[model samples]
Target: AQSVTQPDIHITVSEGASLELRCNYSYGATPYLFWYVQSPGQGLQLLLKYFSGDTLVQGIKGFEAEFKRSQSSFNLRKPSVHWSDAAEYFCALRRDYKLSFGAGTTVTVRA
Candidate 1:
């Protein structure tokens, strides 16, 4: 079985500050990893994905993620967060033709 774990349930980042979200996964082989962001009353939007090649992948909205196979982790990071970045972030793992998601981490941007 494959599962994803997001250690942080909620994060509060000051506007223009850097932010990082941790994610860990359990799977037998290298699995597809993705980061998605969802705004209030909106569906999940794909931030970035790691299929095979690169360990570090960039996404929209100034977000990026790195896949570290040795650590079984794929963490999302933003150099400078914006007020609009406040939203729920999800780390997903795709395996066996199914996607397994974490509980999610809600980011709250503070002034």
Candidate 2:
């Protein structure tokens, strides 16, 4: 069974500040990893994925993530986040539509 868990239900970041979103998974084998961002009540946008190879993967909207085998975690990071980046960020596993999602972390960007 493959699954993802986001501990933080919501996060608040000042404009131009750094942001980190945590994600942990349970899988038999290394499964396709993904970070997606969706505006309120909108579709998801692919941030990045680590199917294999480099554990450190880069993604869209200046987002990146690292795959840690030991902890079974893949965390998302951004150097400086803008208010426009404010959205509902979801961490999803790539094992068919049966994707297990976190309760979604709503990012509040303070201007």
Q: Tell me, by TM-score, which candidate is best.
A: 1
Worst 10 residues of 1 by lDDT: 1-10
TM-score of 2: 0.92
- Number of clashing residue pairs in every model? 0, 0
Q: Each model's TM-score, in the order given?
A: 0.97, 0.92
Among residues 3 or more apart in sequence or in different chains, the pairs in candidate 1 whose N, CA or C atoms overlap within 3 Å are none
lDDT of 1 by residue, 19-57 (tens): 999999999897899999999999999999999998999
> Which digits, one per residue and each the tens of the lDDT, describe model 2 over residues 70-98?
99899999999998899998888777656
Worst 10 residues of 2 by lDDT: 94-103
